[model samples]
Every structure is written in C-alpha cells, then in structure tokens.
Target chain A: MIKFSWEFHAAIENYKRMKRIVEFYVEGFTNLPDWARSVWFIILLKLLIMFVIFKLFFFQNKLKKEFSNDEDRANYVIEQITIP
Target chain B: MFESVDLSLVNWSRAQFALTAMYHWIFVPLTLGLGFIIAFMETIYVKTGNPEWKRITKFWMKLFGINFAIGVATGIILEFEFGTNWSNYSWFVGDIFGAPLAIEGIMAFFMESTFVAVMFFGWGKVSKKFHLMSTWLTAIGANLSAVWILVANAWMQDPRGMKFNPDTARNEMVNFWEVFLSPSAVTKFLHTSTSGFVLASVFVVGVSAWFILKRREILFAKRSMVVAATFGAVASVMLIASGDSSAREMAHTQPMKFAAMEALYEGKTNAPLVAIGLIGDPQDDPMDSTAHEDFRLKIEIPNMLSYMAFLKVDAFVPGIKDLILGNKERGIMSYKEKIVRGYEAQQTLVAYKKAKKEKSADEAVLRAKFDDPQWIDNYFKYFGYGSYYDPDPLQLEKNAFTMIPPISLTFYAFHIMVILGGHFFMLFLAILWLLFKNKLENNRIVLWTAVWTIPLVYIASEAGWIVAEVGRQPWVIQDLMTTSKAVSQIDTSSVMLTFFLFAFTFTALLIAEIKILTKQIKIGPKKEGRKQ
Candidate 1:
C-alpha cells in the first residue's frame, strides 16, 4: 500500500491523467468488497467440480448403458418428455 | 542486460502460446467438423425413420462430445494466455479484438453449450423434433464460434476499425461494424471453417473404412462413407475457392507474407509459380535469400503467380529483395527507412508525454509539433518500429535483408499443404464415384487409402497454419507491433514452467480421449437397436 501510494503520488504530481486513472482503479480494487473477494474462490471451486469431478465420475457414457438400441433410446426419450 | 531478459521472456511466452494453439487446434477442427456431421445424420434419421441413422448419429456425437470437452479446456488457456503472455498486444488492440471474443462467449459459446446439453442428455428426455433441433443448434453454435475466432485472428493480420490513441497509449475502437464485417476476416473464417469441414469428413470416412476392413457392420460403414465423401467433396471445392481468395487477400493486405509463401526475392511482373519447389542447396546457390532465388530446381507455371496475386496476367508483385533493399523503380520503400520514421515518431511521442506530464514551458511547443499533420502522416505511422538505428552494434553487416523471415520453412510448409490438398481433392472424387456405383465396399484399395488419409489431413492443416504464422515472423500484429514488443514484461522461468505443465496435462487428456474413442468405435453400432 505504501509503495502504491508513492507511485500514485508521483503520477498525480506529474499530472499523468492516464496513469492517474489507472492508479484510481488500482486503489478501488485494493478495497474490493468482501463478497467480491469470495466470489473468485466460489467460481474457481464451481468450475473444478463442473469440469473435472462431475466429468470424471457422473458423466462417463449414458447412451450405451441406458438403452439396448437406438430405437429403445428414442422411445425412452419420447416417454420422458411427453409431460405424462 | 534488460534487452536479453526481455528477449528470453518474449521467446518463452511465444513458445507457450504456439504450443497451446497447436494442441487446441488438434481437437477444435474435429469438433467443428464432426458436430455438423452429427446434425446431418440426425436429419437423415428424422426424414427416413431409419434407426440405423440414429445409431450412426449417436456414435459420432459421442466422439464429438469427448473431443469438444478438451478443445474447450485448452481454448480457455488461450484466452488467459493473451493477458499473461501478450498483455501489451491485448492492451493495444483490446478495444477491437475484445469485442469479437466477448461476442463469441456470450452468443456462440452459450448457444452451443446450451443445446449441447439437450443434444446429449435430452435424447430420451425430449421429443424427436426437439432433440433434432437441439442437435442442429449445437452444430450451428460450434461453427459460429469458429467464425468469431477467425475474425479476431484476421484483425491481427490486417488491423482495422481502430485508431491509435496517443493519450491512452493504445489503439481504440472507432467503428465496430467495420471490424465485424472486414473482408479479410470473412474470407479467413470461410477458408478456415471449410478446412475443418474437410478434416472432419476424412476422419469419418477413415473410421468407417476401418469398420469395413473388419468385415463387420458393412452396411453402416458404407453408408457413413457415402455421407462423409459427399460432404467432404463439397467442402473441398469450397476449400479450394476460399484458399484462392485468401491468397489474393494476403497479397493485398500482407504482401511480405505473400512473398515469403511463394519464395519470391525480386519484384517482377509475370512471376512464374513453382509448381514443384526444390529449395536451398548452397552448392547450387549460396546467395538464395528469397523464394525465387532459393529455388534450386523447379517446374514453373507461366504467369500464374502474377495472376494469383493480382487477378491479372502481368501485374507486378514486390518480393523480399525489393521490400528490404528498396525498389526505386517500383516505389517500394525499404524497412530501414520505415524504421527511421518510426524512431522519429517514437521520440516525439516520448517528448509529448514528458511535456504533458511536467506541464512545463516546452509543453505547448511539443504539443504543436505533435499536432502537425505532416508529422502524423509520415513519422507517426512508423511509431511501432523499435529502432531507427541498427538494433545490434556488433552485427554491422546485418541489414534489412536479414530481417526478412526465413523463406525455406514457409515455402516447404506451403508446398506440402498444397500437395496434401490435391491428394484429398482426388480422394474425395474417387470415394464419391465409388459410392455412386454401389461398389464402395468392394474397393479395398480406396478404402485403405481413405482410412490412412485422416491423420495426413490433420498434418496438412497444421502445416497450413505454420505457413500462415511462421511466414509472418517478427510481427505479432503485423506492422502495428513486433512480437518482441508485444510480450508481457514477465520472467522467462515462470512462462517456461507453466508451458510444460499445460503440455503434460493436455497430452495426458489427449491420450485418454483417444483410448476411449477408439474403444467406442470398435464397439460399432448396436445390433439390438434393430429389434424396434
């Protein structure tokens, strides 16, 4: 924070508008809400579960196991989606 | 010290990015091509009410799903890599390139991912028409994604719809529509997508041929071959047409790449095409620096190069020799001169920034100098050049000629791709003919030929990329910025470490996917399906 202040001060003193704007954004980022910080971790965890864990275990091969043949598969599909 | 550090950083970053792109491409074209083929099969099933068609569609869909997952995985790294490795380039053209990429995610990827769920899981969970629609949507989504990716890549080769903002120290988007509808982008998308289609066709045909060779599922194998051959033949025609137009487009927008591809060293009218190229034997010609001069032996097609480049019999095309050493007669300026202009503009920009920062008495003077239209028209355009002076002092003998990309790689890669393309063209015709005569299954020779050509087609596709990319060396975004300048300011070791990690992971996944896919293919379509 101290180092950033020095850099930000230098830019502000020099009147580097682009640098100033960037520094302001950086400052805002450093103070990001607690919820926002956890959001990153949650997203990362979700992605891991969705792409890796679920893929490896839950979704291996459904087409071959559920039905004996293509027609049986088609019939099973029609039965499920027909709204009873 | 800093120079060497930056150089290593750039090289490592570039190496990682290239490796990832190559790996991603292996799976992507298959996904792009096979997705549509699955849709085609499902459509036939719907129309004919043949359960065999459904079986075929499902089989291909299984393969597509496996490949698509990995392609998606590797592709995520490519986007992140832009920020991690080529951050400078991202900042410079983000205003333009980001739009297409954002649209790709929001529009194409979502549509594809959504329907993909319905296509895969909704088989027994949805009505026949609904499932069919979902499958078609999935295919459309995949192709649409390719279009956006190609557009982003094309913009790098021929930058448009943006103006360099001196104040922001970056390029800013000025016209969204121009960027979206660029002819270069459209042509590139067309050529790239069709190539994927042809690759997918060959893959399908090859797998079917294997089944036929086993003397099992002969009917299913023959029918799949018929569909693939027909699809591939139409795609091959489109591929050739798109390729020709792409060549013309390159000649207009990226003349250096065009010159390197043909190995032409000297500017000329009526330049002959080397139909069969033999390159670089020092015993024959030690002085061979450009494509034309490098050809040790060749069969030339009269005026074809000129015709291809300009759509005219006698149009002039500038080569490496003319572009570097300067062509007085042709009014083609040298790279050295451009470098000088760039350096001057860079110096002025630095001065302007300093003055603006300090707000000193010289600020007005510097601002006035910057405002001069003449300065912007001339020197400012070359502001991206790293040096007006020689970049290396020890290599005093080195000139702009040395900066031209190595011609041999581009030339050979191009020739190999062309040769493979010709092979596919003939093979497609033969397969189509055999299918028409109902003798496809009996033709053992062509069946083997079709089966073997699948991997070779993939090789040809990679070679085509090598030709396009390596042929445009030094430039990451062409004249706008060199690759060295475009790299993120990061340490080399960090990049190298991540590169190997990704390579190992991807390779492992690829091996697993191949094992599973081959096993599934060996199983063939279920015979029990016919009981209905």
Candidate 2:
C-alpha cells in the first residue's frame, strides 16, 4: 500500500513538471524584438515623467490658488473694516 | 455556455439610478433657479423701499425653504449612489472624480448650508446688511455646487485631464485645469445653470399669475410677476442660445451621439435632420432593410440636423449602422456586447452549479451535453445568428440581444425640448408686452396661460435630461467603459431593497413639500398696510 501511494504521488509531480516544461518551451519561442522592448520601456518612463509634472504643476497649484484667493479676500475685507 | 441571461440585476441598477437621479434633479434645478429669484427679490426690496416687494420676497422665501430642505435630503441619496450602484466606477475614477465631490462638500455645501440657516432664521438676530449678504451667499453656494457636479459629470463623458493607469485599472487626473476647462464641461455648465434660472423664474411667474387670477394680494402678485417675467425672458432667450451651442459642441466631441440623436442611418455630406419620426425597432440592425423604417410626418427645418451636428450644413454625420460595422471590422466589440458577455458569464456559472450534481448515462457525454455552449448557441440564434461569421457558439451567445436604446424616443425628446424652448421664448416676450401695456394684472387670459405653462417647465427639464443621458446608452463612459462593467459586484437583492426604501422616503418628502408650498401660497403674502 505504501509503495502504491508513493507511485501515485510521483505520477502527479511528473505531470506538473512536464506541464511547466511545455509552457516554458511555448513562451521561449514567442520572442519580442529588442527594439519593441526598448520602446515599451521608454514609453513607461515618459508616462512616469508626465505624471510627476502634472501633479506638481497643475493639481497642487490649483488647490493652492483657490484656497489662497478665498483667504486673501477675507483678510483684505477685514483689514479695510478695521482701518476705517 | 448554455445559460439563461438574467437582465434583472442590470435592469434593477439602471432603474434605481434613474429614479434617484430624476427625483434629485426635480429639486436641484428649483434650488439653483429659485435661489436667484430670492436674491433678486431681496435686492429689489432693499433698493426700492417698497413694502409690497418685501412681502413678495418673504412669500417666495417660504417656498424656496421647503424646496431647499427636500433638495438636501435627495442630494444625500445621490452621493450615496456613487458608492452603492457604481462602486467599481467609484474605485476606478475616484482619484479624479472624488476631488470635485469632496470640494463640493467642503466649499459649496458648507457655504450654502451655513448661510441658508442665517438667511432663514436670522432675520432680526443679525444686521439687515448681514442678512442680505447671507441671501446672496446662499445663491452663490448653490450655483457653485452645480459647477462642481457638472465638472465631474463632464469629465466622465469626455475624460479630459485624465489618463488610464493600467496598474490601478483606473483613470487618474493629469491636469486640473484641463478637467475644468473641457469644452463639454463649460457648455454643459452654462446650459444647465441657465435652464435652472429659467425654471425658477417660471415657477415664480406661474404662482404669481395664480394669485393675480384670484385677485388676492394684487400688489404682491404684480411685483412678483415683473421680477419673474423679466428674469424669465432673459433666461429663456439665453437658454436657447446656450442650448444651441451645447448641441454644436456635442456634435464635434461626440459625433456618434449626435448622429444617434438625429437617427442618421447612413453617413451623408448634408444630413436632413428628422424633426418627427417613429423610429422602428432599434434592436434590429438599421441596415437590415426590414428592421428600421421611418414614418416621417413633418420636417421642422431643412438642413437643421447638418447644422446642429457639424456646425456646417455640409459636414457628414455617421449613422449607427456605419458605427457598428466599423467597430466590428476593427475587432472592437460594441459596449452592449461587453455588457451582454458579463451577463452570459454570470449565467454560465449558475448553470455549472446546477449541472454539477446531475448524473447521466455516460459521464463525458453528459458533461458535454450539460455544458454552457449549447444554451449560448441558442441565445445567438435567437438574436439572429448571421450578423457575425464567427461560428463560436459562446461568442454569439455572449453578444446576443446587445443594443443601445431605441433612437425614436431620443430623437423625439430632443426635438420636443428644442421646440418648447423656442415657444417659451416667444411666450415670455408676449407676456412682457402685455405687462408693459398695463393689461397683465386684469388680463385673465394671459394670467391663466402663465399659470398653465408651469408644468411645461418640468416637462422640458425631464425631456432635456433624457436626451443628454439616454442618447449615450450602454456606455457610462463613451468609448472607454460600459455601465455594466462599471457596476459594483454586489447582490441585487441589497440594491432592490434600498431602492424601495429610497422611493418611499422620496415620495413622502415630496408630499410634505407640496403641502407646505400650497399652504404658503394660500396665505398670499403679507399685505403692506396690514400689521404683521
């Protein structure tokens, strides 16, 4: 019984190993051009750069400007009333 | 997969959103437009020193208060819908969409709610100037709220100032200014705001006309009419102009939608817009000679469709058939196909569970027989199997019964809104003429006409929204995502239960609002000579 169970486990392990080998073989032949890979990397870098620039220049500034305008207007009015 | 397509869940979601949005909108426009009416009335009272104007202001203020209370309640439900029905969409676009909503809560809501309390209850407690300031601030807050909400909606439609992040499976904001300054955003904002102004003004005119007809509170009615009519006339004219511009912008940015609105079946250099026609079954292919038939009754204007769609009478409008064929040839499935596939997948899972327990003569044969492929094939055949040459039964079933809304309702609704808008402009002018001639107060016919026109305001609003939203069916975001794909993975029962609860609460609040408004109208504004 022990010998039979060991044989069954071995069969399952071999099946999984064969499946991995077949998948790797299929993937290895499906090669992309080096230029294409490089282009993809470059595109990713460009996107990252664009994201940073947009966050720093647009989103942050707009929030600052909106809040500042309200604060400034309130302060100016208060100052005018106090002086008068 | 052989599976039964259960559209119950998707249908329920659509119904829930539509009901909530429609009900919320009924109150929203009133708040925006009536806020201005109140501000204008208060301004008149402050400037002219006419006690009659003051009485008129107070009378309208009561109605405005009732609307504001209900509007806030409905608004809370609207915000919750984003998380409930559209959880996935909220998660995806939350980075961008959440900004405007949060700003609305922080900036617009707080400003409006705080000042509204002052405007309502702080008449003598605060200084007169301060109270007046509160009224103006409330109006500003309401308009500002509208601005932020429109900005968010326009972004969804146009997707400006955002880019897809594959890692997050979402679109994130790129430039705040680009989002704010989108052509769709600006046009939609102006058109919506102007429409609100018109609606509010019309309400004031209608109620004041009723009072005039009754011959009670003549001074108050007359004053209210003058203010409402003047604003109504200006807003009515501006609304027409803005609406025209909005349509033109839609033509350039969303040509497919523009084409759908006109029900254009074939691309043409000079398209004659169908003013009135019964669009036959849209579920059938427009190119299928027997499927789509138009019974044309009258043409309102020649080459109007061309002008509205292309800003030029000669520009081409691509029809639905062309769009569908083009997408198919390009290997890009329609939004409806994607949604249907989702439903098919869900149905297949259910079938798999049911088949899991059954035993048959041969295990392999039974498995194949009970598989999802058979039902999927039947579904495809039912929808017309020859539309695509792909023999895969699974794909066919997945794409079966996938169609956008019928073009007839959309086309007619759009035309009705435009025609009514034009007629209202003339009506406003005519009423203004009568008022100037000093016959408005005594002219029962004109007063009755004004009173009756009140319901048309609501109709026009509903029709306009139907055109704007329904025209872009199957897609929550045009060319990017489908509404089915955007819906959250939640139990339909939960949504259905909440839907019933919301409907009940909304109806009860609506009844309460009407009761309060009618009571106030009967009171008929305080008389000038009579002591409070």
Candidate 3:
C-alpha cells in the first residue's frame, strides 16, 4: 500500500480553500452595483481613444504624393486660367 | 451520441480543412491589400490624368486577378467543409452562423463579384470615370466579404448577440448589431485588414526593389517604392496598435487564453510578458505534472503583460492555473462539460414539467428523484468523472471535439508577429525619412531591408490567423456545439481521397503562381527601352 503523507493532504486542502476564496470573490461581483459594471466599460473608452489616435494622428497625411508632378503641373495650368 | 466517427476520417477532415484554409489565407491578404492599392492608383489617375500611373495600375491589377482566382477557389471549399466534415456543428449553430454566411453571399459577394467583372471588363467598354468607380467598388466588395466572414468566425469564438432556440435545437441570432459590434469582430477585422495592407505594400516594394537592383525601369520602381513605403509604414504601425487592442480584448473576454498566451500559471499583478520559452508538452503526463516546476525561465520585459492588457504597469492579468482552479471551485465546468450538463439539465427539467402537467404520481416520483442530492451528484459524476473512471465508455461516445487547433503554436506565432511588426514600423519610418532626404536610393542596407521585409508581411498575416482560429478550440461554437457532433456523416475513406487530390492540385497551382511571378519579376515590368 502506498501511504500518502499528511503534508500532501494539507496542501490539497489549502488549494481547495484558496479556490473557494477566489470563487467567492467572483460571485461577489454578480450582485455588485451598477458602478461595478462600469469597470468593464473602461475597455470601450480605451478602444475609442485608440481609434481616434490611429485615424487622426497616425494614418492621416501619411500617404505619399506619388503623382505629384502631374498634380502640380495640372494645378499650375489651372492657376493660369483667365476667364471663369 | 449515436454518431460514428473513424479516427482516420476525422484526422483527414481536419487536415483537409486546415490545409485549404491556410492556402486560401495566403491569397486573401494580397487580395485585400492589392484591392486598396488599385483603388489608390485609380484615385491618382483620376486626379492627375497621368498615363504612367494608369500603366502601373494595370500592371498590379494583373497580379491581383491571379490571386483573386485562387482566393475564390480555396474559399469555396471552406464553406462546403462546414456542411460535409462538420455537419453536426452546422445543424447546431446553423441558425446563428448561417445568417452571416447568407448575408455574405447576398450583400458582400454580390457587391464584390459584380463590380469585379465591371472593373476587369469595363475599362475599354465604359467611360474612364465609370471604370474608376468600378475599381473602388471592387475594393469595397473585397472588404465587405471580409466583414461577413469575420462576423461569422467571431460568433464562433465569443458567441454574443444570440439566444438558444430549443425548438430548432440551435442558437438563433437575437441582435444583429450585437454580432456586428462584438469586441472580437471589430479588433480582428482591423488587425486582419491592416495585415493585408502590409502584405500588399511589401509585395509592391519588393518587386520594385528588384527592378531597381537590376537598374531597369528606374522611374517606375522609384514611384512604386514611394507608394509602397508609405502604405507599409502606416500599416505596420496600425497593425501594432490594433494588435495591442486585440490582445487586451482577449484578456477581458477569454482570460484563460490570455493566460495561455503569456504562459502564466499563477495570478499576479504587473505580470511580465514572456517573449519566447520552451513550453513543455502538456500532453505528456509526468512532464505535465512537473510542467510548472521550472516553467517560466525568464520574463522578457517586466510588467509588459500588464501594460498590454490594461495600459498600466501595475494592472493584473490572471494566469491559467488561477482561472482553472478558480473555475473548478466555482462549479464552472469546462466548456464541453457545460454543454453536456446544459443538455441533461434541460431534459430533466422538461421531464419534471411534463410529470406535473400529466399529474402522474409515478412520473412525479421519478422527476423528484432527479432533484435528490444523491441523484444530482450521480448525474454530474457520471457525466464528468465517467471519462476519468471508465475511459472505454467515454471513447464510445464522441465527447471531445475541437474546431480550434493547438494553442502553443498560436501563442508563439502571435508574439513573433507583434515583434516583427514593431521592427518593421521603425524600419519603414526610417526609410521614409531617408527617402525625403533623397538618400534612400543610395543606401544598400535600406534597399535590402525593404527587399527582405516583403516576405515578413505574409508570415505575420499567417501567424495572426493561427492565433485567431486556433485559440478558439474544441467547439465550432463556444459553449454550444462540439466539432465531432458537427461533422457530416460521410465515409472516412472518401474524404481522405479528396484530401490528397486537393493537396496535389493546390500545390501545383501554387507552383505555377510562383513561376509566373518569378518570370515577371525577372523580366522587370515591361520596360519601354530596356532589353529583355
């Protein structure tokens, strides 16, 4: 017969106890006030901030002027128009 | 429970789907990216009336056509596989999943395919402005296709905006907006689309660089590089930002996965992200028990995980050990167990209700018997512990099935993609600065960097996908249906034969694509004065 030590049993018990505590903590959130639900709402706020920063600051004006010569020449010709 | 599955059949089905999906993905990114490139080229043509720009647009369009054809071919098989290999899954989630597929066909597919025809054939037949509009429409169509497909895929992973329909024995869509606005759907779409842009940019830059290296079509190469580098720089940076948000979303929605990705076993505040480590094979029994003994060798950067997840250094991200242990105590079963328990619970509840309605004392006694502590315990124990205690019975029943692939590969692949993305962001920005200073053309190192980074873009796209699809394993639809339950009742040998045939044909087409692309690259984009 393989004999298990008391210490191993104690460790298992401790694990079970810790697990119970964590469960209680999570369960507490279920009955939490509306304010607590707001904590999860922060993720949405951050996403908006990221999108604005990405679109406005990062991607804006970053595209290269590949056909600048033709554009510039066309603009110059338009600028020289005498009659509307 | 009566479903019969041969191991070889299941394995072959899985292999076929995986292979086809992987191959299809190779073309998908190029299509998304090149579509945008063509749109921009046409925009330029419209604005400037430059014939040279028009010529460049036509040149790129040819390559896009080749990629589009392959993308369509491989994509057809994926939709068919859901009905064939995963018949049970299709029936289970068909109410919810099928909606997006139908929408894709009606809305996105029609828009893209119709415009694609016009874009390809309408150039000479229609006015220039009309042709340009057609190009833009095609680009939008491609992205629309992405939107619908991703909407369907995202529902599988997270499964929001839906309700269970007992009448149909499947989940039905309750809110279309919820499905469309799912956190996973948005982040994944942006990240995937941006990756496609990166791939397209790199392809253009690489081909152009090759042209310059040979000292042929110098002006064309120079122009192409400018456009490619700009798109590459912006897209690379955006990929990092979107990837960061995607990771954070995963941390919130799928904490176990986030923990797995970081290889965390314990709960800790300000957890450091690990860049790379040898993850011990968890399938090996003795090895798995000792897996965490010397598990994490090094923390790549202290508090990196916290920063990524919470955008704050002191923020906490829970580990797998914490999540699993926490769930066990909470009586929260594993996803598969939960599904089974849910079914059993529903059945028992129905029986109880029927007994009450019929006013049958014996039936009432039977229903009340199920409510007894011993009976309830036995039910859970039989369903849950039966696999552990009696393995043969469990084997007889197809209790385990995963639509998602392995985690370890996806975890590492995601990290590598992020690291590479960061590197390229800096490299492209530096190259942009150099180009502005007129020194980029003269620098051998910068030119070569542009050349090599082209393939890195595709690698990153593939890795990102592996993370997305593989991370959502075991269920075709999380908490709703198992993949084994989903596979169509087909003979195993038949699928295996078809699998080999597809693999061969796909390989041949891929080779042909490469040969044509290589020959074109060597010829250097139809130069006016340069000799062949």
**DockQ, each predicted model:** 0.01, 0.01, 0.01
Over the full model, what C-alpha lDDT does candidate 3 score relative to the true structure? 0.64
Native contacts retained, all candidates in order: 0.00, 0.00, 0.00
Ranking by TM-score: 1, 3, 2
Question: Could you tell me the fnat of model 1?
Answer: 0.00
For model 1, the interface Cα RMSD in angstroms equals 29.1
Better candidate by lDDT, 1 or 2? 1
DockQ of 3: 0.01
Model 1, span B1-532: residue lDDT tens? 7754544777788778888788878988888888888888999999999988988887787678767765565566777677666655666675577877887878665798678767765655578899999998888888897777788888888777777655555667778777777888888888888899899999999999889888988888877877887888899899899999989999988788888888887888998888888876532122323334756688989999899989897989988777766788888877767776766676665666667778878777766765577876687665555332455632311444545665788888888888898898889889888878878788899989988998899998998888878888767786767776666656678688777766776676677567667766786666533311
Any runs in candidate 3 off by more than 4 Å, and if so which?
A: A1-84, B1-8, B278-290, B293-299, B327-407, B527-532
Find the candidate with the highest TM-score and give its number: 1
Residue B182 lDDT in candidate 2: 90
Q: Give the per-residue lDDT digits (tens) of candidate 2, residues A1-84.
A: 999999999999999999964654444324422322333344344344324532233223221233355334333222221110
Return the clash pairs for model 2, or none: B1-B372, B1-B373, B2-B372, B2-B373, B2-B375
Best by lDDT: 1
Q: Give one digit per residue, the lDDT tens place, for model 3 in B366-458.
A: 556544667555452222112212124343222332212354676688777777777667766776687678776678777787788877877
DockQ of 1: 0.01
Lowest lDDT sum, 10 consecutive residues, model 2 chain B, at B380-389
Off by over 4 Å in 1: A1-84, B1-7, B282-292, B361-377, B391-399, B528-532
Between candidates 1 and 2, name the one with more favorable DockQ: 1
TM-score of chain B of 1: 0.92
